[model samples]
Target chain A: MAAPPGPESIALLERFVAALKAQGVVTEEEIAEQIARTDRASPEIGARMVARAWTDPAYRELLLRDGSAAAEQMGVSMAGAPPLGVLEDTDTLHHLVVCTLCSCYPRMVLGYPPHWYKSAAYRARAVRDPRGVLAEWGTVLPDGMELRVVDSTADYRWMVLPQRPAGTEGWDETRLASLVTRDALVGVTLPMVAERAAA
Target chain B: MQDDAPPPATHDLGGAPRFRCTPVEPDDAAPPDAFGKRVDALRQLLARKGLMSVDELRRGVEAIPEAEYHALGYYERWLRSISGIMVEKGVVPAEALKP
Candidate 1:
């Protein structure tokens, strides 16, 4: 009898690709072009809600009360998608996001989480040492910051909009929006200061 | 290509060991032609969008000669591991890297 196919054989390649597609990452475009037959994402809607939450105390309270409804109120569609939970980071407890199961996330709000956050190294490490995971992402916690790692399984999606840094007391929404790194918003890393060296 | 890679023995995921599927350097266990294409595919998926670590992957990819680099058998496993590491580092969309 023939040996099972080698890892690089064409048959193996097809199997891997098919397996990956059967998973969700390959489904976004296909979900639109062939399967779902529509284009609907809630990134802008989520972003706006995050911004509003940062601005108004009442709105933030509302968001904490009902994440899905709050997201919808911002004009983001969440039809046929999993539930979303927004995590808020404070001086005491900082949150990091990881998908131990298949990479399930709130794609509607955040668009796409960065690729690195999905590695096996990340999966094992994040659960094993949450603080270490943040360090790799270059997050130097404040003088007294606590770390919390949240698991984003295939069933439920989540997002994070970290607390605005201290210096930008009166910055407008646009400026604040610029501070939200894709990873930070998703809770993998902390919001960073993208300093421009003076000429 | 990492300075600290899991030892040169076959890759052990859980208790099941995945022997060297890609050809290793001549001195290693993989035959001269074992893992050429499998490495290629892993490199392609990792290199897709400046996501995975170039230095590390380049080291692994460059270690094997092109001729023997194309025969790895566990394609799915390679993506799983590659994407796992990528996801670990925040380089893939969670869903994209999910197993």
Candidate 2:
């Protein structure tokens, strides 16, 4: 938006990339493919993991125990990446993730972090007033639910395993996965029964 | 800004009070801006080349002056860190990056 960087600066960056290529540190092909891989890293992977966890108890156990390994088992490659942690949102406890320091995220699984996720307001308020922040994101949990604010402070990135919506008892994985939005996985909102029915 | 509060660090923003309702819209479909992509690619190349470690990049980003830290956007910080680290490490002379 608003033309991020001017042409001169961009030309300088192009020259920088050329220098790197010339040094044999990286190639244009590798950079292109990495960009493509960034695009491929989407919430769909998290959604599929959630859907599988909802349908399979053993998989849910595995997901809760070792998130990175479970993700790999489901064909999501996080090899050599920092450990991924999945927090289970239950009847009494809800998990909300914010990197108050930096915009650390599970980008390997969830594609790009949302703009607000990296905002100063979010980083500051999510820890101070999580309920207020969640309400701003259109999520208002029931009164007295223990809100657990998890910071991505260290090497671990977190994603919330939101509770499965009611009234989707017989739904298949595809149908269930359709209801799992990125925001839901982030614990800012819940998967709506209406969304599941629409699928 | 609390007068009696601890000195502000660049990254310790949790629970610091400045109440403002900043609503965010979903931009999942919008493509990344050109400079953002280039900066990200440059970071990868820099890391791969052993010129900069992810830890070093994080440290550089965290070390950005406090005023600029609040002023810069997400990728802008990465760009600044990449530029700053390249200069600090002498991988590229500062003049080479001058526009």
- Can you give the DockQ of every candidate in the order shown? 0.04, 0.47
lDDT of candidate 2 over A73-137, digit per residue (tens):
97888864679999999899999888988777887778778777777777888887888888776
Worst 10 residues of 2 chain A by lDDT: A1-10
- Pairs in steric clash, model 2: none
CA error at residue A55 for candidate 1, angstroms: 0.9
Q: Per-candidate RMSD vs. true structure? A: 14.2, 2.6
Docking class of 2: acceptable
Global lDDT scores for all candidate models: 0.53, 0.78
Q: Which docking class does model 1 fall in?
A: incorrect
lDDT of 1 by residue, B1-99 (tens): 498876542221111223112111111121112233343334444444344553444334334433343343323334435544554565444554232
